[model samples]
Target: MFKGFLTLRPSCEVCGLDYSFADPADGPAFFVICFACIPSVALAVWLEVAFEAPYWVHAFTTLPFMLLTCIPPLRPLKGWLVASQYFYKAEEGKLVRLETPRNDDLHPHSA
Candidate 1:
């Protein structure tokens, strides 16, 4: 826990095992921002426009609500994403090569 954020090679708290394979990268952060920020902002805008709320009301309510929505869920979302990655053995996509060529390519003019 002390060095979890500082190092990529953090260990499991319960099992005390190495977590070398847990490389979710920025995926969790990206998800949190996309899902949480979008909806919060959208709702905030809607509420402001619909109710004609004042600037102070928007400032006090919307910002804190946005923070609440994003901050609390971030850790769990990141954990879930990382855990899902590990559970599924997810990896980066690699370039594939064709092992054989089509017969039409070789016999283009034979017909």
Candidate 2:
């Protein structure tokens, strides 16, 4: 399903499913930044505040941890999101006309 690490193929090879609808965009990145990166940031902050850690400590510890948390899960998360979009048939909303009774239909006896 993937053409590259973060890119998708144009369509599915086996099922011939078009990938045009799989526009996950920054959803995977946003999730990684919001959910995954927080703990790494917290750890860095705590180290700085509590232990007064040096830059090299962060380089060895926090940097690797952040990369591990943030980068690796992106492809899986994006695939899951795209699969969900396909399964749920997610699409843009459209304005639809509702059928309501006109005056003639509501007051047929009055006529």
Name every residue pair that clashes in candidate 1.
none
Give the per-residue lDDT of model 2 (tens digit) for 1-111: 998899999999999999998889999999999998999999999999999999999999999999999999999999999999999998877999999999999989998
Name the regions of candidate 2 deviating beyond 4 angstroms.
95-111
Error of 2 at 104 (Å): 12
Q: What residue pairs are clashing in model 2?
A: none
lDDT of 1 by residue, 1-111 (tens): 224432444777777766676776777678878988998899789988899899898899899989888877766666777678778988778999977978988899998
Highest-scoring model, lDDT: 2
How far residue 20's Cα lies from its native spot in candidate 2, in Å, is: 0.9
State each model's CA lDDT, in order.
0.76, 0.95
